[model samples]
Target: AQSVSQHNHHVILSEAASLELGCNYSYGGTVNLFWYVQYPGQHLQLLLKYFSGDPLVKGIKGFEAEFIKSKFSFNLRKPSVQWSDTAEYFCAARSTGFQKLVFGTGTRLLVSP
Candidate 1:
């Protein structure tokens, strides 16, 4: 069975700091990658995705991720984060021809203002 893992369960940081969340998946074949973010009281939004083409993909809200096949990792990174960036981050994956998504537990980011 395939599963996703998020290394950080919760993270706290002051405003204007860098942020990085680790995501890993257990799958042998091709997969679709995604990073969805949920704001304080909002629904999930597609922060970024890696379907094909480049291994490095950039998404909205100044967030980006690198897809490393060898490591089975897709880590999200932001050089400078703001207080408004406080949200819960989830890493998800689906098989090449599958529509169902397997989501990581999630990483809650608390950015202090």
Candidate 2:
């Protein structure tokens, strides 16, 4: 079984501020990691993912994450955030050959303009 942990429960920033949220997963074997964002009144959307190949994964809305296998971390980052980027971000992990996804508690981001 795989589990995820998000250290940042909440974050506040002004527009154009750089953002970084910590995410760690527990799983020794091959696993897939993902970052999902849920905006106000919107469903969860995929922000980025790291399955294989390069560890740095680029995603929509100027988001990116790097998978560090040794540290079991997949932290998300953005060069500059916008007010529209405010959302609840979740980190998830799924071991290979598994059918279920383990998710973190989620981090709430509030960007002020």
Candidate 3:
């Protein structure tokens, strides 16, 4: 069975620093990718997604991700980050023709003002 992997367990950055998180998956077929953020006590917020069309997906809050089919990776990146962007980011993958969502280990981002 294919699975998701997030090598970075935790990340720290300044309020105006850039943020880049790694997200990779192991699947042989076409797949849908997603990036979700969970604030301190809020529900899951979808940051961005890639279903088709352009390989690069622009998500909410100035975030974007690139889907590399050959690498099976959908890395999330933000040109600049703020204190409010501090949250737990999750990378998820769902193969085509399936309704299952496989999530990565999760990456915790900390931003200092």
Candidate 4:
């Protein structure tokens, strides 16, 4: 079985500041990595994902993540952030050929203007 771990529990930032959220999974086989976000009062939305080909996958609203297979890591990043970007981010992993998804607890980002 695979498990997801998100080191940061919460983060606070001002507008225009950079962002980076760490994520890691425990599985030796092929897997699909993802980042999901939930706004203050919205449904969970997919941010980015990596299943094959490129390790560095870009997501909506200037967000990106790198899949390092060897390290079992998929860290999310953004060059600059805005107050609207404040949300709860979750890291998820689904093993290849599997339908079940394992998600990290979540990292909350609070961006102030």
In model 1, the Cα lDDT at residue 50 comes to 96
lDDT of 3 by residue, 1-113 (tens): 88999989999999889888999999877898899999999999899989999998899989999998888889999998999999999999998879999999999999999
> How many collisions per candidate?
0, 0, 0, 0
| lDDT score, candidate 1 | 0.96
- Candidate 3, residue 40: CA error in Å? 0.5
> Which residue pairs of candidate 3 clash?
none
Residue ranges of candidate 2 with Cα displaced over 4 Å: none
Winner by lDDT between candidate 3 and candidate 2: 2
Clashing pairs in 1: none
Order the candidates by lDDT, highest first — what do you get? 1, 4, 2, 3
lDDT of 2 by residue, 1-113 (tens): 56799999999999999999999999979999999999999999999988899999999999999999999999999999999999999999999778799999999999999
Task: Give per-residue lDDT, candidate 3, residue 4.
Answer: 98
Sum up the clashes in candidate 3.
Answer: 0
Residues 7-95 of candidate 1: C-alpha lDDT, one tens digit per residue: 99999998889999999999879999999999988999999999988999999989999999999999999998999999999999999
Candidate 4 off by > 4 Å: none
TM-scores for every predicted model: 0.97, 0.97, 0.97, 0.97
Distance (Å) between predicted and true CA of 39, model 2? 0.3
Alpha-carbon runs more than 4 Å astray in model 3: none
* lDDT score, candidate 2, position 100: 91
